[model samples]
Target: IKRLLVEVQHVKNMKEKERKRKVEEKKDNRRWIETQREREKLEKIKGINTKKYRKTKKDIERKRKKHTKEEIEKTELERRWNKEKKSEIKKQSDRNK
Candidate 1:
């Protein structure tokens, strides 16, 4: 009877150890899941920031192109005005002579 009681106690101890191991495993899994969720959230935020950066870069490029176009138009208009003034001055000098 004493030997039987010892065997029963050993079995109970083994079951307790197994239960503790399963509980620890569950905790580890929960921690891993939380970490994965955080990592995905950070990745999503990074993606959004990257998209915003690209949009800002494109806007700056568009503005630069528009400014250059306006500058070219302004210079062309000045050139035409100068040419008209020169022609008018020449015509007046010829009439005077």
Candidate 2:
């Protein structure tokens, strides 16, 4: 009878240990799921930030192209004015001679 009691107590202890291990496993699974959710959220935010960065880069490039076009136009006008002035000076000198 005493041996039977010892065996029964041993079985109970084994079941209790199994139950504790299962509980710890469940807690670990919950923590893993939470971390995965956080990682996904951060990835989504990063995607949005990259899109905004690309848009700003395109805007800056467009502005730079417009500025270069304006500079070209101004230089063209100055060159034409200089040519007209030179021709007028040549004509006046020929008349004086």
In model 2, what are the clashing residue pairs, if there are any? Answer: none
Q: Please write out the lDDT profile of model 2 over residues 1-97, one tens digit for every residue.
A: 9999999999999999999999999999999999988876786667555565668768889999999999999999999999999999999999999
Q: State residue 48's C-alpha deviation in candidate 2, in Å.
A: 8.3
Global fold similarity of model 2 (TM-score): 0.48
lDDT of 1 by residue, 1-97 (tens): 9999999999999999999999999999999999988876786667556565678768889999999999999999999999999999999999999
Candidate lDDT values, in order = 0.91, 0.90
Number of backbone collisions per candidate, in order?
0, 0
Ten consecutive residues with minimal summed lDDT in candidate 2? 44-53
Candidate 2: residue 67 Cα off by (Å): 31
Alpha-carbon RMSD of each model: 12.7, 11.8
